[model samples]
Target: MKHLVILGAGTSGTMMVNHLIGKLPKKEWKITIVDQYKTHYYQPGFLFLPFDIYTTQQVKKDGRKFIPKEANYIQKKIELILPKENLVKLEGGEELPYDILIVATGTNIAPDEIEGMDGPGWYKDIFDFYTYQGAKALRNKLREWEGGKLVVHITEMPIKCPIAPLEFVFLADSYFKNKGMRDSVDITFVTPLSGAFTKPKATKALHYLLEEKNITEITDFNIERVDYENKKIVDYADTEVEYDLLVTVPTNMGDALLERSEMGDELNHIPTNKATLQTLDHENIFAIGDATNLPTSKAGSVAHFEAEILTENILHYIKGEPLKEEFDGHANCFIETGNGKALLIDFNYTHEPVEGTFPFPGVGPLQLLKESRANHMGKMAFKWVYWNMLLKGTHIPFVSANMSTKGKHFEKMES
Candidate 1:
């Protein structure tokens, strides 16, 4: 029997595993999924964790609960990936062979990548909300502390949930106001981008929102290193921004095993065919979600959309037929913008997010690029959809693998 091996059981891996079940006969193929961790986190919920919108109990769970019966789930560390031999070396020196491989290894926070970022002030005066532990630590710090200069910074780009740091600052503004310290705590949103976001249009909207909230925005500040001793982040041009509390999103990279395997790019992301979701290096391998070096938002919705197209391609690959390039990097994300409101953005590799109605043209229950309470509810309701429907490989109603232009209005396309 041929074997299908999947790496990582995070959002992307979990969904991909569910997509493969029952499609391949259990008698003919054995599916195995490996992950280092037992518990799965709702990573997007990490944004709310520090602010008490979501408790740890709500975001954390055993990943095995959602796993399918047809696959063998292995809870072990990946020590190495010998891609040339199509084998994965586990911690105990055992090797697992695969006829087909799916890489969903996902990305990680590398605090050490920046000088002095992981030093003395980490989790004391400085913290991250990306990981469960970091968010929880930051939560504890936020509770007892009196606020001063609060700097919300991003070390680099391509981090998960690009809007989250901004969300944190907005939430912090609201949080401090509720605590009656709004006037005292100085809030600054520091980013490396020339503007608020990667897309210029959305940047304009978010820039206005930041101004409305009375939060400061520091643009084009490329962080070169952190001076933990002085509690400052210095830019490449030697501009220094000091912070009493540093809430940072560190540099993000793919799994170290990918680097060890000699099968990934500079950031350790696997080189993937953007449309096919197949690895450029090997025909027997496929990549999905944050593991791919796709020029798209590494969000959960994108992974779900990519999975639909990749599932079809996998079947074609097994049948020895030419695969269709249907995946268009479709992604839609709802950014929670405090005070029970949020904004949604929908775009693909070629299109930037434009102002329009979503899911239904001119009759959307949800609006795109506009802030509303409905968008917040849409964002919250996704958690249920994720657990009950998405991870089980069910397609979201009205959502397709390609970018839907029916409800969206684009002045022009980029890329």
Candidate 2:
């Protein structure tokens, strides 16, 4: 019997397990999943944590609860992945050999990477709402925050759900207004990017939103270090901004096991064929979710799209056929603009976000690049879809693996 070993029973790993369990012949391939963690976090729920919209208990479940009974699930930490030897080393000194290896190790916050970031003011004056624990802590701190200079920061790039910082700002505005401290609080967005977002058109739209919301932006501000005792963030240019409270998105990197194996890139992300989700060095090895160095956003939607394409590729590889380069870097994400409304953006590798209607061209249940109650509901409704449909490998009816350019309003290009 052939052995298929999967690492990290997170969203992508769990989905792949469900996908293969029912698809592959049980007598030919036996699947085994390994993860150190017991509880799985509803990561998107972290965005709502500061607002008291989601509790700690609501966002957590045993990781084993999601794993299918058809496969062998092991709760253990990975010490190293020996791709050349086709084996994964467990911290307990046991090795699991595999015919096909799928790495879904995912990314994690590395606050200690930044100087003074995890120092004196770690979770007190400076709090990160990225993790379940961090978000819950922020909720407690926000409850008594009397309003001062609130710094919304991004230490570096390639964080999971890139738009989360902006969403945090929008929600914070609404949060303070509800507390009657809108005027008393000064909100400043600090980022390394020269504009509001990755794309220029989206930046224009976002810059307007910032002005409209009276939120200030400090562009190209590459944060060099956090002065914990002084309550300030200093950039390389000697520029500094002090904050009464710093809500920051810290550095995100892949697992330490990647470093030990020497199978990862500079940042510890696996070198993968972006479209195929296959490892560069090994044909039988594949990577998914935040673990891969794909140009697309490290998001759940990206994982969903990648998984669909990867499933096809894996089946092809097993049959000794040419793997399909089908993944188009398709990603869709919602930006919470507050007041019970959110903006949706959809695009692929060659295309950036443009004005458009989604799902349906003329009459969308969810609009694109524009804020609406319907889109907001779509954002909220995804929580249900994530737990029920997405992770279960059930196909989403309205959403396809590829991006749709129909109903999108594109600006005329100039030569």
**Candidate 2 residue lDDT tens string, 1-415:** 9999999998899999988888888899999999999998889999998898778877888777678999999999999888889999998799999999999999989999888998989889899988888999899999998999999999888889888999999999999998888999999999999988877777887888999999999999988899988899999999999999999999998988899999888888999998888999999999999999988899999998888888888889889999988898888998899989999998777788878788888778777788899889889999989888998899999789998878888653332
Give the C-alpha miss distance for residue 379 in model 2, angstroms: 0.5
* Clashing pairs counted in every model: 0, 0
Clashes of 2: 0
Tens-digit lDDT track for model 1 on 282-396?
A: 9999999999999888889999999888888999999999989988878898987888899999988888888889888988989999999999999899988988898889988
